[model samples]
Target: MSKRSNWAVPYLIFLVIFVALPLILIVVYAFQGQDGGFTFKNVTNFFTDGDALNTFAVSIEVAIENTLICLLLGYPAAYILANKDLNKSAVTVILFILPMWINALMRTLATAELFNVLGFSLGKGTLLFGLVYDYLPFMIYPIYNVLLKMDTSYAEAAADLGATPVQVFGKVTLPLSMPGISSGILMVFMPTVSTFAISEFLTNNKIKLFGTIIQENINSSMWNYGAALSLIMLLIIGLTTLLLGGDKENAVEGGTV
Candidate 1:
C-alpha cells in the first residue's frame, strides 16, 4: 500500500462525519417529534398534504418543460458551433457563453424587461424562461464538444454519394450526437429540477419547485418536514442521475470500449 492510500482514512472519516452523519440526522430528525420523541408525523404529513404533492408535481413539470426547451434550442446551436468554420468558431463560442457572465437574477430581470417591451410578460413563464436561458450553455457546450470531435469526412462522403444536406444531417449527424445531446439534457434537467433562486425571484414565487418546497419548509417553520421534503427532492435527483447515468454508461460503451 502507499501513503496516498492512507489519505483515504481521513477522507472516509470526513465522509462519515459530514455526509453519512447528516443523512442519519435527517432521518432521525425526520422521525423526531415536537417533544423530542420518535414519530412518523412528518412523513405522514408529506403523504397526506395535497398542497405539497401538487407543488412537487408542478416543480417536476417545470424541470421537464425547461429540459425539452433547452434540447429544442440548444441542439441546433451546438451543431452549428461544432461544425463551425475556423474563423467563426471563436466568435460563436463567445456569444454562446455571453449570458453566463451575467448574474442569473440580473438576466431574469432583463428577461422580464425585454418581455414587457414586447407587450408580453414573463409571469408564469418567469421560472421556465430563466432556467432555459441560464442552462442553455450547459446543454450547448457538451453537444458542441461532441460535434467538434466528429469526423466530417463521413458527412462529406455521404453527401458526395447523392445524399442531400437534410438527409445526411438527419440520418447521421443527429444520431451520432445523441451522446452529447443526452449529456446536455441531463445536465440541464438536473439543476432545473432543484433550482430555487430563479423560480423564487422571477416567477414571483407563484411557482413552487422542489427546491422551493424545501425552502418553505425550512424558512416557514417546517423543519422536520422541510428536511423530509429536501430528502425527497434529493432522492428524486439522485434517482434521475442514476437512470441517466446508466444511459451515459451505455453511450460511452457504445462510443468507445
Candidate 2:
C-alpha cells in the first residue's frame, strides 16, 4: 500500500493534523477538569442536567424519524430506477440527485419559507420537511446505485415463473437493494444526529436538539459538557453504522464472479 506514490506522505500528514490530533484533544479536554487534571465531573454533569437529556432525546427522535421517512419514500423511487429501462434511467437518476446540488441550508430555509407562504408557519413540522428534503438524496442515491448493480436475471426469472411484478420486486429487487439502503441510512443518520445548523436555523430555538446542546455548551465555554455530549453523539452514530451489516451480507451473497 505504501508503494503507491509520494501522495501517501501528504495524506498521512493531513490525517494526523486534521483528524487524529483533534480527536485526541477532545478526549483530553473532556476528561480534565478545573484542576487541570483528569476527572469524571464532565460526564457526570451531563446526566444530571435536564437540558442535556431533553436535547439528546429530541435529537434521537428527529434522526430516527428522518431515517424512516427517507426509507419510506426513497425505497420506491430507488426500486423503480433500479429496475427501470436503461435507456431512460439516466434522466430519472439525475432528477433524484438534483436537489443535492442546492445548498442544504438554503434548501432547508426554502422549505420553511414555503410553509410561510401557505400560512402554515414554521416549527417542528417544518423541521421534519427540512430533514426529509435535505437528506432524501442521500437515501436515494445509494439505494439507486445498489439496485442498478443487481442482476436483472433474478427478477426476470421470478417473473418468468409466474411471479407478479410486485412479488418479483419484493423478493428480489428490494432485498438486494438492502445494501444501498443500509448505506443510505448510515449516510443520512450520522449528520442528521449531529447537525446543529438545521435545527438552529429552522426551529428558531423553539426546539432543543443534541447538536444544539453541543453548540450551546461550546458557545458558553462549557467545554466539558460539550465534550461529554459530543462523545455520546459519536457513540450513537457509531451504533447506527452497525446496522449497515445487513448490506454487507447481501453484497457478499451476489458478489461472486
Candidate 2 weakest lDDT stretch, 10 residues = 248-257
In each prediction, how many residue pairs overlap at the backbone (N, C-alpha, C within less than 3 A)?
0, 0
Per-candidate TM equals: 0.83, 0.89
Q: How much is the lDDT of residue 229 in candidate 2?
A: 76
lDDT of 1 by residue, 1-257 (tens): 99989989988999999999999988887888788888888888888899989988888888898989998999888777766564365886889978878887788778766776786654566667778889998888778777878899979988998889998998888888777877787788888877887777676677777788888778988788887777777788888867777667634432331
Clashes of 1: 0
What candidate 1 gets wrong by more than 4 Å, as runs, is 8-18, 101-103, 109-122, 160-162, 249-257
lDDT of 2 at 76: 79
Report RMSD (Å) for each prediction in the order shown: 3.7, 3.4
